[model samples]
Target: MDFATWDDRVEKFRIPAIQYRALVESLQAENTIFNDDAKAFYQVDLVASLEMEPYQHQSEALAAWKLAGRQGVVVLPTAAGKTYLAQMAMQATPRTTLIVVPTLDLMHQWYAHLKAAFPDADVGLLGGGSRDKSSILVATYDSAAIHAETIGSMYALIIFDECHHLPTDFNRVIAEYAIAPYRLGLSATPERTDGKHADLNILIGKEVYRKRAEDLAGKALAEHEIVQIKVKLSQHERERYNKLMQIRNDFLRESKISLGSIQGWQHFVMASARSQAGRKAMLAHREAKEIALGTDGKIRILTDLLAEHYPDRILIFTADNNTVYKISNEFLIPAITHQTPVKERHEILTKFKEGEFKSLVASHVLNEGVDVPAARIAIILSGTGSVREYTQRLGRVLRKGQEANKQAILYEVVTEDTSEEGTSARRRNEPQRTQRTQSKEGEKKGDLKVVYGTGQKKTPRAAEQLGLWNDSGDTPNF
Candidate 1:
């Protein structure tokens, strides 16, 4: 959609009418390149001189900043060089820069990327495990919230990475304390289903730029194939599942109760079990139901898929620590999670990059903000219908590399006829009117389909050397 269309929708969606008109009028009035005070000495030559060529869309985004006076959020997709845009904002200011990130992993990623892009300048990390002493500081929202007063008025510009998280009071406090005249917020999936878009708009900046997934597919990306593989419930588990369903349905029928209720939690308990003995039975029934759902069986099948797609770098993401541990141990893959020691996590990630390991399992630690671009394959073990998780996992494999037709395979294992399927559908179509064009057209068995990223970067030769694959095409011991 055009800028005018977006502005109209923003107003219709309860955006402050005055702010909407004012922002548009301001953009119309100032067609100048940019207006930062510190940018007087800034020149386009510096960007060209940095040994990086900006893509057409990247240049357009930069131009939008200049034309719009650089006062809005720029929503670039993951792997779309958001770091470059953040760097450009920093260079334009040429003063102290404070970048607020959502996680420690991303804090380090930004710190490392910034230092490499501008080797002559000092950069510091302010996350859990890093020191904080450079003019350009990378901090987690938790740190920013607590230390806002400490860094008060020292920065000329503030850049929020994964800025969608700022709706929380803790992170938003940093923006309130900051005196920086220039601000830029970046994210691949910026909208939350909870209707916090207005707070996100003001908390960061306006939505000044956006690009959908389908637009990049087959051009800057590969043609993706998504397949849904279905498995039947084991006989024993199926018997238990059918019995439990009958009991729950009977409760609903007798009570004239609907699942969709404002006070659903209490009703769910009453429906599932009416007494202490019944509760115990219901808990056992759930355990059996989960087993019948085929999550563990699906993981085994996924491992077989990896074996077939051997030597391919894979990232396995799950929301449950139990599942993360289970997959890592069952598949004998090196794993990293939030609980993993920092040094250990760093070492495993380095090994993954160096091609020493073929696959790694993780919890939500790698969900967003962090950059693990060497990963060409991803399997989503479990998560709520989070659009951010879906997009970020896709980004892990979308970065340009040597792997031709390298795919971002997301295996979402959901229990048939469960609430999980409904949640998955909701998230799959989360991106406003863009959903029609963003999604592929088809329906398969169950409710959720396996979503894969269609883009290939040739896998480096190192992937093979690391023992991720062999001539026999089997899972590697590493």
Candidate 2:
């Protein structure tokens, strides 16, 4: 009988580590005597008892994960207790576990939670300047990938937080080399724009449990409303936007490039780097996007909405750091960007949570896995076409809080008659296309309101004359 043999050159088995599962299954089917020594070091007694009872969906998710031989991804919306669900999985499996997180903040957060969950257990940290190893360990993806070959066999169960990030080239190596018999992946938005999320089926496992934001609305999450506010660019801004768009359009036509797919965008980027005209076109595109995203009219509308929701905890989201800082300065609000120090970031969040700060503005730092349950109002001043960003920002406010009757409000400020109109529509349309039918009922689209400038009111007819609002009265489906 033939079995896996050691390979001296690679310092690994002749067969790839990823095939261990199939090999073991095949050997078992043939009634072969298989001595499993790879996981011998991982034998440990783990007792993880939850302080709070598992929610209904959590129990169902746990059941499904266990039913799948303890291997698969669990799709739960942000604030739907994905962390707790991971804890439940840990408690159920009760084996040497390795939890991989995407960010250092998340690594620390998981480390804290695990320590609290199992006070007596030996937990370790493997990222952010720490390299301790124990029966239960938490590590950042970059650190885990760097040490995958060495530490892959130390855990019997591996859980990936924000599992969508696991399909990347470098990160996939962690899962490929790890011989963990049981795997679990958790994510709110698992589908990547590049379509690489399909690889999770092989890298981790097929999705075993799933729930959308709307599915738990009013039950496990706060009821939410999506409001769209349309604002027309000023005369000068409008002219500039048109001119820049014309240049971009000319380049697209001459280059025969369609910016529909990821590959097309990459081609445009490469072409822009090589030719002067392409570079000019790319510059024009960026100018147009900036003009559309940060128009004076949108700022005025934002001011008004902030005034209206001043009493509620609001989160302001933007596409870039420039906009975040701009808004922060204009409103004198605390801002968090990639450049913000970790200590400062945490301090700002603490103050905001304590009501010392009513609003906090951010670019992309708070998009995922950051807990801010007190925030009930989220204003999207500007963002990308990514649905994940849209949903994540919305989820920041959907976390259940003491204000059980409080409604979560997401205000999407758009520049009317610009490319932003299409971008906003596409982001809102994503959930309708992918989410479960039950979740769709929670999304209620409000009437589109047009604002001229700060503290200025215009009649509906005046807005219509400016071509800000359409006559059909059909709002963009949220």
Best by TM-score: 2
TM value for model 2: 0.87
- Whole-model lDDT per candidate: 0.62, 0.80
Q: Report clashes for each candidate as comma-separated counts.
A: 11, 0
lDDT of 2 by residue, 46-151 (tens): 5666568777778777777766778899888788888888887776677788999998878989988888888889999998899997888899999999999988
In model 2, pairs of residues that clash are none
The residue-by-residue lDDT of candidate 1 on 202-239, one tens digit each, is: 65567776665545555454334444443345566567
33, model 2: CA deviation in Å?
2.2
Off by over 4 Å in 2: 1-13, 41-43, 430-447, 450-478
User: What is the model-wide C-alpha lDDT for candidate 2?
Assistant: 0.80
